[model samples]
Target: MCKLYQFVPIFCISLSVVCAKECSIVVLEDSNEFIKIADCSRRGLSQVPQTLPRDITVLNLRRNNFQIISNFSFKRYRFLQKVTLSENKLQKIEDQAFFGLSRLNNLNMSDNTLDLLTVYTPEMFLPIENLTVLDIQRNIQEHNNDVYRYPDVAFGVFKKIVYLALDLAPIPELGQGFQNLQNLKSLIFDRCFLKFLRGDTFENFTSNLEELRLTRCLHYFLHVDDNALSPFPKIAKINFEGSCMHLKQALSMLSSYSGKTLDIINLRGLNCPRFNSDEYPFVLTVTKDMMRYLKTVCVETLDLSDNGIVDFEENSLLSFDRPECIKHLYFKGNRFAFTKGRQIDELNTFFNKSIALKTFDYSFIPVRYWLEENAVHHNEQNYHSSNNIIYLPRSLEKLILSNLLCNDIRRHFMNRRGSNLTYLDVSYSYSNNVVIFESNASFTTETLVLDGHFHAALYQIEIVNFIHVKTLLWRSANLLYAMYPLDNMFYKRFITWFRKLKKLEHLDMSSNLLWILPDDLFLELDRLSELRLSKNLFQSVPTQIIFCSTIKTLDLRNNLLSTVDYATRVWADLMSTNHGFSLYIEGNAFECKCDNLNFIKWIQETKVDLDSRSYKCTLLNGTVITVLEAYETMHDLFSNCRNSIWLTVSSTLLGTSIIGVVLLIIYSKRWNIAVFFYRKFRKMVEKNMVKVTLMMFSFHMAGTAYLGLHNV
Candidate 1:
């Protein structure tokens, strides 16, 4: 007692104490009566603490080497609320480790050595109903449910927990998994559930569950038979990020008609195939009456991704309601090449029917494929556009159509009309002079994302008399727009028309051909806050932009950037006179030689947003090498010889030497250095290639074995 009192120094003084290579301890003597155990990091203690003080509240034993925890090891921690034991060596928890924690709430056990929970009893966590968050991740141990046993009663307590994570390993079994959990909200099961889940496993989720996740689960071949998910009727949301590539039998097995579920269904890793044809069929199938019955289905967000199905029936679109009432549709990462006129007509039908649809995303498809296929859906025989998708839905708000080819640009040639919707993301697209805008239409749109492509001349955009748009995103506008007299009068008309948009808040023109913003562009709508102008052709930032007091989050990645002194000159003008702003200069190829070196050094030393990320440079001599991969010094980014003497001398010397050497031992045959090197490299590469050149070897072997068996 005397030693404890002496060590309980109630002062803010530095106290350093090193522990064993596998063990460390920190005693925080706060102004209060309890001892604050803090930072027992990087030690190798394999067991749970046996001598924890009763009054300790904040215990941080992160980055250690702990393994097992017997009964009553932490039963005395009744008031322990915050405990972080991340990156440890602990595996199994034997029931009573969390016995009587009344006020315990946040437990972070990330980066541990546990794979699965084998033995847990009801007495383990009886007093823990007030927990709000729990995290246990990164287990290096093996997980096999045949050997591990479930807890006696898992859901008996901790019902009020909000955020829960078993990220490292999977939950082995559902035996008494969620028995009394009445108010569990956010649930996460990452890389767990190695085997198929036994139905009736979640029989305890009788109450309304908010968010449910199954990320990286091994046994994604789970089905809902009889009483499988009976208790979880009020589950509003579910995210099934299965580790498999495809779901063959899953749709038939998991599709429930209970009518109690609602909100969202995120079929993530939808690209991963799960079942084989022999094991589970019904993939890419238009069978029986399931397609017909899908008409009555309703989901907020439908994610059908990574399914490499190139051809689908046109009637599939008709399955959805028209003037469409769905919220967000994600079709990215799928090989959805265009179909024929019949499919195009069906899409028109679906769009006309479902009017409430808000967002539609079809980004990341190949430019050629999208253009060749969907952009130009010909009438089976002809390869030209007909009455293919002539109208855009009125309910459309946010649309992402990216990576389109120039042919598709021609097809969408501003000749078509669309809704005056809110948001549009048309980046990674090829825009040409094909699209024609209707006169006097007064294009009324908000938040247009024109990043990642060459925005052709503003025919419709520039000629429009009164265009009302808000939040213009012109990032990655590398190419030239079509000819437009958008100098003084054009800016006046455009700004006047744009100033009518009272809701304008953000203006992102990053990575564009913006040498300078049209003179007084910022004075029009002062409500703008988020401005992004990174990765552009700006030799000098206009000093007038500093007056934009409302602007924050400025991006300036990758451009013909000059000195850091010039950047500071801009920031200094802003900070010294006007106000505060964040600056980004990440990928700018600045001349970092003698004079420019000072700018680079100053940028590093200042509070500017260099972001600590590496910048890649394309040098002349080291042009073949990557800046990130090469261990070269930073001076190479700006160092270049002023005189052509080095180039001339080196070239002349090499030429003379080559000529003399050619006279001495030049090969009369066609065998040169290039030929020799190419042959050697090709031979070595071919030699070192994988031996299994014959793909589908298993199928070939199976066929051979079958033939042999038949002959016998």
Candidate 2:
């Protein structure tokens, strides 16, 4: 009991010592670069590591146990340019803690226990004159339940600050003392509690701020007074995503920034006010009056994703007086009402005037209700309208319709010329609806993405429909069968379909559960340079790829390959010799064995470009090693294999040589050998005959003596 009591203290002391050692800082060395970095993250360190180099330019001390930043704590790091002390237990930063960091341009002190009273002192940030980016978000924790307002002069000294993130609670107003921050270009106030934006809220910014983010600040609505953003004439970008504001408030916000060309306005999830919610469910249509102020504000990109917007008032897009000014629009995660065949006319007329609009994303729009409504309407009308075509803006180049219901996209785009659209994405569309492409209704988009499962009725997506497609992405389509291997008919169809894309340059069929491809799959794709078959069930390098001379990059990552065979490597080497070829085989199951010695050697010597990292090969005894380590010590590991191969070749040559020499002796002395055998045979025959004759003579002499005796 006494020994156990004594050992407790020793063990505790040893544990503390080990923990101290684990908290040691690490300095990254860059031999070819001048920037030195010190990383002390997640170490439970109570204080900064003083052993770091004085010339370190970047320091990361996030997620530590630092309670306070003492005065002049970083005075030694004079060359420091960026420092992050986020996610720490910091309660106070003593004045002059960053006294000598004159070159510090960025500082992050977010996610700490800092209070406004202790952090807002005049001397707290007086030394960082060159600092351009400062993030102290989520640090103004409540003290005694009293509302704390930011002081006017708190950040007045940071005249050169370009970006500031103040994602704290209960910030009632941006104080008037920010007039000195004339160079402040970006400001973020995400998750703040105070809602009202008065006209003078940003009047002190002196018109230099270019970007403002008030994302998710007001959970319900954010009221903006008229001319609230009139002070910053150069403000180009604003994000109010998830700020459930009324349409009038949004118009007021845009009105304040009139005559200024805003680059992006992201109002995703606006949750516009619904009129007569009990009578008309899901009727949050964007009306022309709600967008009247947008006519004065020339915004280039507007993202209204997930806003519960069902339909747009006719000529709503024209509310932007100069419709050509708006270029990109995102309407993802909305449920638009497409009831009848002519319901697409609303969309056609809505964007008919936006001639310069280039990109449009309408992904994730559910159409289950629309399908039911259309069915009911069709039953009442007793007729079907096959001419339900959608007319997109002629100037639009890129369109994304992913995760929506399939509505015969080729038929919708039948009127669009091949050269008008550049990219089209119909991936993840509903599988129940069948899409058929008429011979004249093919899309000539440069890029086409067709991922996810299509119904069995979609046996032929028919690559002829995408004859001009240069890049095709067909990932996760389940090209192979589930319970059985790929059928010959399906394989032949794939071959025939892909051969039609004569202009295909890049093809990605990743995550397709594919084991092999037909030999003629890419036969006619003479321009194909890159092929991606990643995340598949390929056990070996596809034999069909060796014949593709135009292929320069082949990505076969995350496959079931145990080892690449010699023939594939030879073909890859040949391709590398003729032209540069990069074969990415990362994330494959590789095995290291004597039989794979040549493959290991090829990895080190092949001219084909292979991934340097993520090539872990398992050995015979279940030991795992990286490709680099295997390359470095492969000679020692497989020396016996090399010796065995040499032994086999030498033994084969020796045996063959001895057999040839014996055959040559028999062939050169054929006549002599035959004559010697003949002479020996004759001698033996003569000896036998002489013995027989002697026996006959003895018998005759006996018979003659007996006859003479009888006569006497």
In candidate 2, what are the lDDT values of residues 1-712, reduced to their tens digit?
0111110111222232324333223344445545666666776666666655577788888988888888888988989999999999998888878889889999999889787654667676778877899998877555232344566586888888999897534435557777888888998876565456677666677687889887765443455676777787778898877665644466667876666688998888766443224422334677777777776777799887877777776656435666678899888888774444445565565568787889988789875534554544434444444544456776778888788864422225333443267787778877233233444554657998888853332364644456788998888888665213445455555555576789999999899888877656767889999999999999998888877888889999999998888888988898888888899999999988788777877888888998754379998779999766777887877778788889999999999999999999999999999999999999999999999999999999999999999999
lDDT of each: 0.55, 0.73
Tell me how candidate 1 scores on lDDT: 0.55
Query: Residue 174, candidate 1: how far off, in angstroms?
Result: 1.8
Error of 2 at 339 (Å): 3.8
The collision pairs in model 2 are: none
Best by lDDT: 2
lDDT digits (tens) for residues 1-712 of candidate 1: 2122212213321232223342223445554655455343554445544454566676677766667666666666666778787876677777667677777888887777654454334565565657788776445356544634444265456767777666423334445556555567766766554444445455545456677676666554443343443455566676766545244333332344233325666664533454545544323433334344334456677666544444466455346532244677776655444433665566666666667777777666653434444644353345554443235566666667766443432333222245555666667665321323454443556666666753342334532332355577766665323213465334444455455645567777765577666556677667776667776677766665766666655666676665445644556435534445566666666443434444544544555444543444344443532233332455455444333447778899999999988876755644786698899999888866644445567679989999999999
Find the number of clashing residue pairs for candidate 1: 34
**What TM-score does candidate 1 reach?**
0.63
